[model samples]
Target: MSLRIGQLPDRTPVKLSVSVEPDLACALADYAAIYAETYGAQEKPETLVPVMLEMFLSSDAGFKRARKALHARASKGDT
Candidate 1:
């Protein structure tokens, strides 16, 4: 999808704010540095979080099944 996981084929914009503890914040900073080193581009780790999550969720079979079922029901006018 992206250079790593689900790298967003498009740059559709969404703004969100999240709260995390100091340790997690430090970890994310570390991750950002690593990601920059790996990808040869310096970008905030937070920028990758949503794509990472989407990729992770995409890889989850249970989520896929549930989403598929929900879609099917929606198409059939059954909530």
Candidate 2:
């Protein structure tokens, strides 16, 4: 399912805060563990969250098209 989830870009880190249920937290932790094992580098769940989110967003074709349309409108001073 995540075959297209490529490596995250190397960039300056930013901090963020979010709240999730215990089960979701555990699931993120599990994903972090698998990500570490898969890539041979351990990462905290905090780090995985953004990378996973970016991967999810980038993989959505409809979202990408809509985002491009929004950008085009914004560039043209349209909302």
Candidate 3:
């Protein structure tokens, strides 16, 4: 029997810990404030970090090429 709905992708969340310098911490807070002002929605710097990282990674050409090569190697079962 075929169903219209497909199996959902993994939604498990992973927690990460990072340390930043005081200046960078202050900058992140300022960025969060500007983000809230620009979008009229309040978001914590922690909440924005993953999204900002994803955006940066998606926009990086070298990372994209390297990621593609890595995926190809993985698919070929290369170490």
Instruction: Please write out the lDDT profile of model 1 over residues 1-79, one tens digit for every residue.
Output: 3465655587777888899899988988999899888989998878878887899998999999999999999999998
lDDT for residue 79 in candidate 2, whole number 0-100: 87
- All predictions: root-mean-square deviation over Cα? 7.8, 9.3, 1.6
Scored by lDDT, the top model is: 3
Cα deviation in Å at residue 3, candidate 3?
4.9
Question: What's the true lDDT of residue 77 in model 1?
Answer: 98
Question: Which pairs in model 3 have colliding backbones?
Answer: none
* Model 3 misplacement above 4 A: 3-6
**Residue 56 CA displacement from its true place in model 2, Å:** 0.6
Ranking by TM-score: 3, 2, 1
Best candidate, TM-score-wise? 3
Query: Of models 1 and 2, which has the larger lDDT?
Result: 2
lDDT of 2 by residue, 1-79 (tens): 5777898898877777889999999999999889888999999998778878999999999999999999999999998
Question: Judged by lDDT against the true structure, how good is candidate 1?
Answer: 0.88
lDDT of 3 by residue, 54-76 (tens): 99999999999999999999999
- Superposition TM-score, candidate 2 onto the true structure: 0.71
Please tell me which model should have the higher TM-score, number 1 or number 2: 2
